[model samples]
Structure formats: C-alpha cells, structure tokens
Target: MRILALDAATEGCSAALIGPDLALSRFEVAPRRHADLLLPMAEELLAEAGWSLHDLDALAFGRGPGAFTGLRIAAGLIQGLALGADLSVVGISDLAALAAGARRSAGVNRCLVVNDARMQEVYWAAYDFDDRDEPRCLGEEQVAPPAAVVAPAGEWYPAGNGWMAYPEALATVHAAANGPVAAIHPHALDIARLAASRVARGDAGSAADAIPVYVRDQVARKSA
Candidate 1:
C-alpha cells in the first residue's frame, strides 16, 4: 500500500510517504510556519521516494481537535492533493494520532492523549491498544478545562502538551504516574499507518470529504 500523509496540528508540521518497502518522512516543531514547511516536506518525501501524487493509493491528514488554523492547513492540503491525484482520502484524529504515538514511543497499552486547546482547556481522549497493537478509543473525544479533566482508572500515562501546559491543574493525573512520560504529539507517519488499515478496509472517503473535526466547536461558541 502506498499512502501519503500530512499533519500540521499543534506546533508541529510533518509529511510522510509509506510504500511496501519505503517509508520517508520529515517533522519539525515550527510554530506558525506549517503553511510554508508542509508542502515542501511533502514534496521532498515524494522526490526522495521517486513517486508522485498519482502513485499513491490514498492521502491522509491529521483531522483535528487541534488549533483551527493548523487543522485546516492539513485538511485543505489533502483535499487538493487527493483531488489532483484521484485518490481516496482518510481523516485521522489528531488526538488519536497522539495516543498512537504515545503507544509507539512509550510502549504503553493504555494512553490518555490530552492536548492544550488553549483558553485554559484541553482536547482529550482515552485509548487502549488492541491485540493487534492498534489504538482503540474508549470514549468520545472531548474539550474541557484542565481542572475538569477526568481520566479512566488504570495505570495509564498522560501524553501530549496538555500535561506540561497545566501541570498544576492536571497534577492528579500526572502524579498518578505510569512513569514520567507525558509528552506526545501527532505525526504524519502515525497518521499514514492508521490510514493504511482504513484504506485496506475501503473505509476511506473522496476528496471532498477531507475535513477537520473541531471537537471544541460548541465549547468555543459557548465560552465566547
């Protein structure tokens, strides 16, 4: 399966290409520079792999519960790329991607992905890895103030920038440490890998379906 994925969620920008024998990617925490860096990163990965958009089976992006601008950047790019390439597209949750990344980097079975959604709130989700080692979301993703956040009971490690953002408010969860490893973020490689399964199952959508999931939509309006 040949899949190309991009993510400009949070403070990171990245692009990745996954083929049967090849995996190429680039990532950087370049705040507000995603628009400038994302395309070039994608182009570089394609060039390194000697592939074009048409050569890919699908295009994927981190469809968010992230910064609105960052989410739109990735989704809009995938929409354009998918349409031009005539390829199916998949939207992977940025929160879920962070959980998958937590599993990958920390070898944790149960992970709590929490990202700072600003305004003293966080976007969060709980995940438990399946037997196949794929992240299985336990409940709906939500946006809440750090003081109101609640995690499932277990030896779970906190992940994403949220922990660092409100170390005091989230201290209970942080104190319940499953080992000091509470920092993770979305990555294009993880997005691509997650999309690979969806693509295989024919669960992907058309180019027009590429869209961001702003979990904080209602919350933002109410707060405002």
Candidate 2:
C-alpha cells in the first residue's frame, strides 16, 4: 500500500511518500513555518512521484507530544487531505517516529525516545527492534519530568531533544546507554514506514479519528 506521511510535531517539518516500489520525501527544520511548508512539501513529493492524493492508500502524521501548535497544524492538514481524498488515516506517535528514525539512521536496536514537552517535562517511551526490524513499544509513553523517567531494560540508545534540554535530569540514563544520536526528530519518512506497518495490520482509521496525542492534560498554567 502507498502512504503519504506528514510530520510537524517538533521543530522540523517533513513530508514523505512510501509505496511498494518507491519512496520520496522532503524535510526541513522550520519552527513556526510548518503551516506553510507541510502541504507544499507533500504536493512536491507527490508530483515528483507522479501520484496524486487520490492515489495514496492512506495518510499518516505524527500525532504528537511535541509542540502543540505544530501538532495541530499537521493534524488539521492531514484531516483535510484525508477527507478530500476519501482516504484512511493513521496517527503514528511522535515518540515512535523518533525511535524508528534512530533505528533507520543509527542502526540502533533499542531506543529511548524523549521529546521536550515544555513546562519542565518530557514525553518519553522505550522501543526495541522486533524480529521484523520494526520498533516495538516496550513501555507506556508518558509525560513527566526528566528525572522521573526510568531507564528501560537493556542497553539503549537515546534520541530526541529532551536529553539535550535536560541533561542533568537525564544524566543517570546516559550511563547505561549506548550513546546519543546526533540529530533525532520525528521524520515523516519514519511516520510513513510505521503507518505502513499499521496499514498492513488493518489498523488505519478514519480521518476524523486522526487526533494528536498530547500526553499532557493541563497544557498551560491556570490563569491568575
């Protein structure tokens, strides 16, 4: 099946198209510019592949625990696209995308994904490459202070911005770790790949069901 994935859940904006025999993508690290970059990037990728929205089997996006505005932008765009094209949609976790990105780019089998969740907390989850070479979630994805994150089982490679943002709190995790990935963002390519796996397992859902995974409930402090 062919899938088009979009990710603007963090500082980066990316779009990818993956199929049985083709893969194409466009990515950029653009803060506050995801609204402008996402659709055009998807269009360009589709044009390059000589395929249109109607040709894709599903649309996937980084349903996030990253920037709230970025997550909304991606989800809104994907909702419109899926509705217009009458396509199925899959919401891939931003954390999972980071894990998948690490495995694809760094060849890491075990991944510890931690994204800065603002308000002095982080969104984190653990993953291990399965027999099928897919990142399998090893534990519950949660939002907590960096120090509250427990180290996952086995030697793990860390990825995402939280480690860089809260080094002291995450210091202990680094000890039993393999190392850090140079650059780790939830790329659309990995979102597409994970969505494909979901599709293969008959897990794709309606466009209206494509909701963002904002792990935190109270996103902001109560007004004084």
Candidate 3:
C-alpha cells in the first residue's frame, strides 16, 4: 500500500511517504511556514519515491488538538490531495501521533500526551498501545489548565511541550511514576504508519469528513 501523511499541527512540519519497503520523509521546524513548506515537502517525498499523488492508496494527516492555523493547514492539504487522487482519508490525532512518537522513542506501552494550548492550558490525552501496535485512547481529549488535569493511573511517560510550559503541574503528575518525557515531536512517518493500519481496517472517511479535532474552539478562535 502506498500512503502519504502530513503533519503541521505545531512548530514542527513534516511529510512522509510509506511504500511497500520504503519510507521516505522530510521534517522541518518552520513554525510560521507550514503553509508554505508542507506541499513542497510532499512533492519532494513523492518524487523521491518515484510516485505521484494518484498512485497513493490513501492520504492521512494530523488532525488537531493543536494550533488552529496549523490544524487547518494540514486538513486543507489532506483534503485537496485526497480529492485529487480520489483516495480515502484518515485524520490521525495530533496527540495520538505524539504518543506514537513517545512509544517509538521510549519503547513504552502507555503514554500521556500534552500539547501547549497557548492560553495557560493544554490539550491532553492518555493512550495505551494495544498488541496490534495501535494507540487506544484511554480518556476523552480535552483542553484544561494543567493543574486540573490528573494523570491516568499506571506507568505512563509524559510527552510534548505542554509539560515544559507548566513544569510544576506536570511534575506532580510525573511524581507518581517519574518517567522521563520524550523530547521529540510527532513525525509524519508515524502518522503514515498508523494511518495505514487504520485504512486497512476500513477506517477511512470521505474528503468532506476531514475535520480538525480542536479541544477548545474558543481558545482556537481566540488564537486565530
């Protein structure tokens, strides 16, 4: 299966292509240039694989609980690409993608992902990796002040810059198990891999179903 994935939901922007035996990717920390960098990056990755958009079986992207503009940028790109290629679309959660990064980097089975929500709050979620290598959401995604969000019961490492933003609150949560937070952001490679699994299970949606999962629209709108 040939799959293409893109993520522009934070300071990091990335595009990746996953073919039968080849995985090619490009990532950049261009906070204000996701709109500019994403497509060109996609073009480059496709060219590297000697494939075109129409050759892809599916398109995937990081859907929010992230920066408003960044989320829209990713969704818009996926929509256009999916429509043009007449492919199925999957919206991977940005927080889940972060958890996937942590799982890959730390070899952990459980993770707590928190992305800075930019209003003295965070977008948070708990994930447990099932045997099938898919992340299962343990709690509903939410936007909350760090102080009010309690850690899930069990051994789970924290990830994302949200903990860095509110060290005191995160420190309390981590004190239970004291696992180190991963220093990596979500990558398009993980997004593509996860989306491939989902697409295989008949879990894709139509292009019109492409939507951002903003935890707090009010905060997102204010930021926009």
* Candidate 1: worst-modelled 10 consecutive residues by lDDT: 215-224
lDDT of 2 by residue, 188-211 (tens): 999999999899999999999989
Which of the two candidates, 1 or 3, achieves a greater TM-score against the reference?
Answer: 1
lDDT for position 159 in model 2: 90
Considering TM-score, which of the candidate structures 2 and 3 is the better prediction for this target? Answer: 2
Per-residue accuracy of model 1 over 8-36 as CA lDDT, tens digit each: 88998889999998988899999999999
Candidate 3: C-alpha RMSD after superposition: 2.0
Error of 1 at 13 (Å): 0.8
Clashing pairs in 3: none
Lowest-sum lDDT 10-residue window in model 2: 174-183
Candidate 1 deviant stretches above 4 angstroms? 218-224
Model 2 scores a C-alpha lDDT of 0.90
What ranking of all candidate models by lDDT puts the best one first? 2, 1, 3
- The residue pairs that clash in candidate 2, if any, are none
